[model samples]
Target: MLATIQKQQNNYVVKFTRPLSHSVDAVWAVLTENGKLQQWMSNLEMIDLQKNGKMHFNMNDGTDAFEEITITDYVYREVLEFDWGKDSVRFELTTTSDGSLLVLQETISELTNHTPKDLAGWHICLELLCDLLNGIVHDEFPMEQWRKWFVEYELLVEDVKND
Candidate 1:
């Protein structure tokens, strides 16, 4: 499903809810493990796994450069939130009777043209995570899925503009 995008005073909040047939621990690993993490979000590398920790974003373009972002409000298996430029991205997981519910929320300090793009990227990342958890591994980024979500998210953001 498309994420719920809404305006909140000075910030624009984007939320994606995913119901997965896996334990919270299993889903948390996908969000935290380096191997599974690279599969979904190759750009981020977790340097520490605690409150006031660090997550580095690699340029991966050349030159071997990276930007460090601080992690805060972290809980071992329940929450993980980190700085994203002037904003923040948070992941929250709750165990269900049969599996788990994963909520991804991005707090955008300002609504810009790039907001939709970031939303689409996060949607695709979660999809990749879903596929990986189900043993449907892809050796590369899921551009096809990303392109599909981008179009849908663009429409979502446009609706926000109209409303």
Candidate 2:
């Protein structure tokens, strides 16, 4: 089972356990390389993989939406860190007895209305990544799941307002 979510410092930590039949290098390539990223993500561009390297991605939709991120730290096949505007995202990979344990820590500058949507999007993207890694063709996100989550998120917001 996946571990329960937790909040540490200014970031939310999500940890998952999976029996990845691939090597750590292979998994790292999928996460860092541009071609593999496009297979799972949408518009994608990456610079040299080094400290302060630049990474950019656009939403799949033709809305011209984009994110500019900077690599803060890089430890081959182990950990990667980046900054997206005011948010800092850290990706850590540990070799387990069976496979790899992946942990993502995302620190936001401030909690705002967009927090839930951002979290939901990341959750879906991570799932998509897993599917791609498992030899499944994941060219796009599952909109039905996104829609369901969005509706539930709206209801949560409404409930919060009433309280």
Candidate 3:
């Protein structure tokens, strides 16, 4: 499903919600554990997981350079929020009768041409994470799917701006 992008106060929030038929622990592992996280988000490595700790975002551009992302909030199996450049990305989990509901919200200080790209990238990542939890694995990142989502997010961003 496409994420809901809305302008809230001075910033924009792009939220993706997924209800998975897996335990909260399972989904939490996929979001934080290095092995499972790499399957979906290869560029991120959790260096220090506690609040005020750090995560490394590898450039992966052959220079071996990386940006240290700070963990702004942490609650075991419940919430994880971190700094994403100037913005912040948060993950919240809640248990349901069937399994769990995962909510990912990225707060953007300003909407730019690049905002849609980041939104689409995150859309793909969440989909990949859900698939992994369901025992589905893709050998490579699906660029085609990302491209499709990018166009949708572009339109959504425009609407938010017009509003």
Candidate 4:
């Protein structure tokens, strides 16, 4: 499903919610554990994993690069928020009767042509994470999925601008 993007007082909020048939712990591993995280989002690596900790970042564009993204907040199996470049990304998990609800929110400081691309990336990442939790493994994110979502996000953001 496409994420909902809304403009706020100072920034834009893009949220993606997925109801998963997996325990919070199981899904949390995919969000935090290096092995599982690499499966979904390979650019991020949990370094310290605590509040004020760092998330090792790699451009993955062949510079053999290393950067640290500060962990703004952390609560095991509940909440994880971290600095993402100039903005931030957060994950919130809630238990449900079936499994759990994963809420991913990205704070956009300003809207740009790249807004849709960023939102689409999150959308794809969440879908891949859900698939992984359900025992469906994919060697990489399906580009077709990302391409489909990227266009949707672009239109959504354009509508916001028009309004």
Encode model 3's per-residue lDDT on 1-163: one tens digit a residue: 9999878788988899999899999999998999999899989999999999999999878998999999999999999999999999999999999999999999999999999999999999999998999899888999999999999999999999898
**Against the unseen true structure, what C-alpha lDDT does each candidate score?**
0.89, 0.68, 0.94, 0.89
Q: Which model is ahead, 1 or 2, in terms of TM-score?
A: 1
What's the CA error at residue 158 for candidate 2, in Å? 9.9
Show how many residue pairs clash in every candidate, following the order shown: 0, 0, 0, 0
For residues 1-163, write the lDDT of model 4, one tens digit per residue: 7788788999988888999888999988999999999888888999899999999887788897988899999998999999988999999999999999999999989889998888888888887787788787788668898899889999999998887
Tens-digit lDDT track for model 1 on 40-67?
Answer: 7889888998999998999989878999
Candidate 1, residue 55: Cα displacement in angstroms equals 0.6
| Candidate with better lDDT, 3 vs 4 | 3
**Model 4: CA > 4 A from native:** none
Cα displacement (Å) at residue 70, model 2: 1.1
TM-score of each: 0.95, 0.77, 0.97, 0.95
Q: What residue pairs clash in candidate 1, if any at all?
A: none
* TM-score between model 4 and native: 0.95
Worst 10 residues of 2 by lDDT: 1-10
User: Could you tell me the lDDT of residue 87 within candidate 3?
Assistant: 97
Residue pairs that clash (backbone atoms under 3 angstroms), model 3: none
Instruction: Output the TM-score of candidate 2.
Output: 0.77
